[model samples]
Target: MVLNYPDGRLYSDDIPKKPAKQVRTTPPSKRTAQTQKKNNFANRGMRFEEAINESNAYYLSRNLAVIHKKPTPIQIVKVDYPRRSAAVIKEAYFKEASTTDYNGVYKGYYVDFEAKETKNKTSFPLKNFHQHQITHMNACRNQGGITFVLLWFSQLQRCFFMDSKTLDRHWQAQATAKKSIPLQVIEAESTEIFLGIAPRIPYLDALDHYIALKEQEHDN
Candidate 1:
């Protein structure tokens, strides 16, 4: 008896048993996963870090500001040198940050600040900040720098430019029952930053408003 398989194979039972389809056995690569995440971010909107960077670039190109993101300090414990030109960092740990995320000169004024994003809808958690950062901001303030924080409420798609001194005041009160800064307080004290197409964050505009308000307060 002879039989013809559905595939192009002629068979007695199956000529040789048609070879099984080769299925992909390889796992998805880490790079591929990272690329997917980046694509998702782009589709939704630029992430806080990316937005700030674009804004900083815009400022620099126009000679409006000279701000740059601070590179995190890393202590390398091990390095593999396959070649002098290629040294792979095998083991590394981040050192504690001594200052904020960004610092530079803006319109002849020293500008120093940290940028943070939160997923909370109503209040910003106190844990996102550190005592050392507060101290660093205080030191910068003492040096007559314009020190503040660029706070992003991701859930609400809202951004605020909060002065470091005001942040420190609330931070100190965290030892009491209050665990977070309410949205109302932030709205009252901080300058809201409307997202822009060119600069993205447009934080400098809020900074200008803050400066004017402070100057007015001083006058009063």
Candidate 2:
């Protein structure tokens, strides 16, 4: 199967698969449970996007906010009908560049943000972002919407909420400065978000803090 972007660039989804490990068919044991516990703890910071989605679901259930991940628009070009009820898409092309990862309304303020994860220990690569996304965020901000990004440092198990304006400044400076955002700069400018149980990525707390700071600036 083959997929392509609107600009005719090849999009490869062919990830190398790891060899399957031998499975042991056995009944439940105390050691198995302990191993499971250790595995759960090890995966505490895995699947950053899933954590954000679960957090959104938690917020929605409690009537705290209405946020959702934006689905990528893809145009199907080829399909294989293996059975009458099982049609498989074999090829597709992206309709266009996507704006952001998530957007919604929180407390009457329009909230728009992108979620990104990086494995780097010291900095986040700017190549993770695109020009279209930056332009869209700026447009939303200009219209009085709260625009930001949720950055997950997977290696450090840390997350930060950075305003789009701050991101834009760094993005534009890439011509002269380093092609990445340093950890020190992010720590200084962004609000840290601590992970939780129900809402894994407790991002709204950071949002509230950002709103308070904006209000203070307005009053001053």
Give per-model TM-scores. Answer: 0.77, 0.77
Clash pairs, model 2 backbone: none
Report the C-alpha lDDT of model 2 over 171-211, residue by residue, as the tens digit: 99999998999999999999999999989989999999999
Model 1 lDDT at residue 199: 96
The superposed Cα distance between candidate 2 and the true structure at residue 185, in angstroms, equals 1.0
Clashing residue pairs in candidate 1 are 11-15
| Top candidate by lDDT | 2
Would you give me the overall lDDT of model 2? 0.80
Off by over 4 Å in 1: 1-46
lDDT of 2 at 52: 88
- lDDT tens digits, residues 157-178, model 1? 9999999999999999988857
